[model samples]
Each structure stands twice: as C-alpha cells, then as structure tokens.
Target: MADNDFVPLTPREGAALGDDVYAVLGEAILRGTLRPGDRLRDVELAARLGVSRTPVREALQRLERLGLVEVAANRYTRVTEAHPDAYAHTTEFMTYIAGDAAILGLARATSEQHTDLIEAVDALIARSERNDGMGILGGTTAFYQLLIRATGNHVFITIMREAGLALQRNLQGWTQPDEDVELRTTRYRRLRDAVVARDGRAAESILMEPEPSALALRGRPSLG
Candidate 1:
C-alpha cells in the first residue's frame, strides 16, 4: 500500500477502532495495493495506520475470516491468493443472494424503487450490448444494491455490505457473454418487465439464471 494513502486514525472506542482498521486494510487488498502473498506485519501496519497493534491484529483476523488474508501463527500473515475458482464460487453466492433479495425486495419496494430497478436492468442491457466488462459489472452491482436495500432487512443489507469487497474483487471485469448478447438482453428485458409488474417470483428466476462463464468455470476440473 502507498504510505501516503493512509492517515492516522483519531481515537475511537470499542469495536469501531478495529472496524476502521479493517476497512482500511480490506480496501487496500481489494484495490490490489496489498497484493496476494504480501506480508502483513502488525507492528508496521499499526504504525502506518496510526493505530495500536491490537487493532491491526483484529483487522487482520477479520480479513482472514473474509478470505482476503491468511495467517499462520508465529510464522507469517499475508494476503491470500484469489483462487482460480473464486469467480465461480463468488458468483454462485451472489446469484443466490440476489435472487432471494429480489424476491423479498420486490414484495416491499416502493414505486420509485420499481422504476429504479427498470433503469438498472436497462443499464445492464446497454453495457452488455457495448461489451463493456467493467460497465456490466458496475451496472449489475448497482441493480443488486438497490434490490437489497429495498428489502429493508438489516441482515440482508449487512451480509451484502460485508461481502461486497470480496465480491467486487472476484467479479472484477465480469462481462456478459459476447455470443449470448441477444439472449442476455432478452432476459434483462424480461427482468425489467418482471420488476415493473412487481412479480417477485419472475424477477427472482431471472436473477438466478447462471452466466455462461460461471457454468464453464464450474465444469472445469478442480485445480486443487
């Protein structure tokens, strides 16, 4: 991570201090500043982030739990490599979450949120047509964010928030299938219609459709 990128943390009480430290290190890892296999020294991080070693240790533990870091007691702590199967794994998790969130959120969404969902799906289709990988990823994430928030369930919101970093890192550069652009666009349109009608089941089904790339990855033999 760049030395100047972080500033010293002001005093805070309880878990908030550790939470702040975790967000800093977690963001660095997601942005590729602290790359896979980079050593994480508590003392160095503590000094750099201007916090005590305790919070640094706590942060690393949280990152480890999130699979962004790995630790070996008394030997070393380092960022973990993104496994070759990470895309498929994270995508599977995301599909299920998005599907369920759509069901619940559609039931509760306001008319304004319904309009937002339509626009979001349109953006997804537009990005797909342009074959813009990053744009597609961004559009898809934004759609899911709106849906999850519409649910107004703290548990769903917190799960997505906590997992958001890992999801972005794993799904970066995700694109709609170039060959299946027409098919994907059709599905996206259907999804938009489903949202307009507030058909929870229909929307959930569309959201749960597996991407061709994810299917291909799942079929590949395990590297392990």
Candidate 2:
C-alpha cells in the first residue's frame, strides 16, 4: 500500500498513532483488503504509514492480540484466518459498543440522530433483502459507525476504530455462500429499533441472538 493511502495521525490533529494503526491496518486485514497469508514487513509498513517502527510494532502487537495477524516460524508476519478468540472478542466488543450507545443515545442523541439511524436501518434491511452481502456488510459498518458517532464520546470513536477492523474480519465468513438475508436483516431491523427507541434492554437481546449465525456472518463479525 502507498504511504499516501494512510490517513496520518497528528497528536494535535487528533487520534493516537498506535490505535489508529491498529484499527486501520486491522480493518484492512480483516476485510480481505490485506488478504490472508499476506506477508508484512515492518519497515515497509512503517514507511507506508509515515511513522517509525515504534507505532508499527505497537499496531502489530494489537493485531496479534485480536488474532488478525500471526508471526510465522521464520519471523514473517501475515494475516490469518479467524480464531476462536477473534470470534469471542469481536462479539463481546460489539456488544459493549451497542450497549454503550443505547445508554448514551437515550438522552444525548438528538431527534435527528434517531431518525437517521432508523432510516439507515431501513436502507440496510432493504439492501440485505436483495441478498447483497457486500452491501449489507458495508451498510452495517456505516450504521454502527453512526451509532458510535451518536454517542458523542471520544472513547466510542476509538472503540469504533478497533471494531471496524474486527467487523470486516467477521464479514469474510459470509462470502462463502448465500447467507440468510431475511433472518439477518430481521435481526438488524430489530436492533435498529432498540437503538432508536433507546431500548438498551432490547438491543442487548438483539446482540445475543446472532451467536448461532456467526459462521454465516463470518469475515464481518465473530463466529459463534
């Protein structure tokens, strides 16, 4: 990847290098943008990111923690297929985001935010009904990004940066075969309602219902 492709982080311009690196690079790896088994050289990455080895090392470590990248016997680093921990961690993290958003969105979100989220859900559900997995994947990410934005919390933004990468990784599992669009969209719609209604309880329930569908939703979310 070209160094210019990187969205640079300035301490003053906002965002931490390590976390930004973790989230951006992690999302690329997860979404097949980087691809499985792609070799990564720290020097090359550092150059591309316009940062030194320090941030790259930190990013690699964070990715390793998420199971998005692995070090080979020869000391080469490459993206890998999802592990059990990846699935577990991604799900848990997403639940945290949704739960937090639900709690904060209640009083904090403007009426416009609620309407926009509901509209996004409707659009996503419509696209999913068309059996467009790619569309669903992209839309889902955007919807959640919006959810985090609605919270108006800086932490949510960072959490979202991390979650975006995990979400893309989860999407990979869906590319195998046609997923049950109806079922998935149904869940998404319900989840959207919970958010709009500011119903943290129902949103929590919606989050829990998708575990069995993890394999189908793979490459985008954690597998059950």
- lDDT (10s digit) by residue, model 1, range 1-224: 66786778876666488889988888888787888899999998889888899989988887887788899999999999888878768777778788788899999988888888888888887876766656766677788899999998999899778877777677654544545667766777788888888888898777666566321211232334
What TM-score does candidate 1 reach? 0.84
Per-candidate TM-scores read 0.84, 0.61
- Candidate 2 Cα misplacement greater than 4 A, ranges: 1-28, 31-39, 44-55, 70-81, 84-97, 128-131, 175-196, 210-224
For every candidate, C-alpha RMSD to the true structure in Å? 3.7, 5.6
Clashes of each: 0, 10
Error of 2 at 41 (Å): 3.4
Instruction: Rate residue 152 of model 2 by lDDT.
Output: 82
- Cα deviation of 28, candidate 2, in Å: 5.3
Top candidate, metric lDDT = 1
